[model samples]
Target: MSLEIRIAASTDAEAACNVLRRSIRECCELDHKNDPAILDAWLGNKTPQMVANWFSSPTNFSLVAVSEGVVVGVALLTGAGKLALCYLLPEARGQGAGKALLARMEEQACSWGVKALQLHSTATGKDFFAQRGYTDAGMVRSPYGVETVFYWKQLDEDTTCPNAPKRKRFCNCNSD
Candidate 1:
């Protein structure tokens, strides 16, 4: 897959949501199971309209991973140093898309002088974040009863992973 990472636009919301839905429903199934209610509640904010709002919001920034012209993954970062979301479709995982998306998000964060990054992760995703240097801050239950684990990483000059490649695949949409 030829992957490119770029800043998301309101127009990309539908495709981004597609990736988010698949990621949450399949890739993170271990966290939500087949419980319809849980899936419904957990995925409520993953709609295209909501994603579009993220694109338009001054407090949020989003990135999309496109492979061969399709949006296969997404990562969202907040102005307050939160990694609001980072998700990839199953087929997009294990092929460097996640790392690229995250690296760019971290780069953007550090560019803004953000000193820390934090996120809530599923049990399935906790290790992935940990491997990239996020320290676990323990777990918390969501208002909807999902047990989500919290992870935090103090940012510095060397916070980025050595394994992350130089971003040579940025799309023109990257400019704000």
Candidate 2:
């Protein structure tokens, strides 16, 4: 099935939260099968307020993936080029939605003049990001207390605005 990607609206908060929660559970099941405590920490304490704050942040840009009119994936960008969240429903796994969402978020970051993108990935997602050109920076403790692997990707410089001054260009050319 073809997935549609678009900027998430306020109405999408609930569905996005559901997708995130399910993704966490699925990741734990697949990658941390022997660690129940870790799984609990990863999926246990999410609240609507946190979800709302994530979507409402001025620095955040969230995209939702829809298939058959249902939200199946979500990706959020923050801290300029930082990938704050990326999740897909279990049923949507292995589909192109996750990659598409990540690509779109990278595009968004580039448009905003960000030179690099960073993210802390779960064990399940670490390999996925690595396959997409992100290099491991180090391991960090996620808010959930699970050790997440941090990754970074340097973006290509924006040459389209070569004649324009660096400060005025859409994407930072310095990071290239």
Candidate 3:
């Protein structure tokens, strides 16, 4: 079935948190490298309650990607224009879920009058954000102590997507 993107409800907290945790553990092998300390620090605050609070916060917008009735991805955009969280399950990768999540977040940001969006990207996500017009700003250490790439993207007032060659299929890839 196709993926469906929508605002995350309180009940989805557990599933969403699972996605976030699993995404970091599996997809971010390059960043954490199976280091116990790093993984613990990174996932310390990712409890279901925290996820629910984040999703319900007035200053934040949270979304989930549902596939076959399962939550497979999650993203959170802050009022201050930060793309705070964007993650997808290993099985959901290369299925257009990430692209759809990002596009939705950008749209929500523009609607909220946010002129730009800033985010810290993992090594695995660097190329993905770059291809979406995010400029490499610099480097920063994540709260968990992982070196991350800082990226910023200025939003067009009109918020229209630019044209690109059609891909043969959806594959969560920067290029097709």
lDDT computed for candidate 1: 0.87
lDDT of 3 by residue, 135-157 (tens): 99999999898999999999876
Cα-based TM-score, every candidate:
0.88, 0.82, 0.89
lDDT of each: 0.87, 0.82, 0.92
Candidate 1 matches the true fold with a TM-score of 0.88
Query: Candidate 1 — which residues are off by over 4 angstroms?
Result: 158-176
RMSD of 2: 5.2
Superposition error at 165 for model 1 (Å): 21
Residue lDDT tens for model 2, 62-134: 8999999999998999956789889999999898999999988887777787788999888888889999989
State each model's C-alpha RMSD to the native: 9.4, 5.2, 10.2
CA deviation > 4 Å runs, candidate 2: 30-40, 158-176
- The deviation in Å at residue 145 for candidate 2 is 2.3
List clashing residue pairs in candidate 3.
Answer: none
Residue 78 in model 3: lDDT: 96
C-alpha-based local distance difference test score of model 3: 0.92
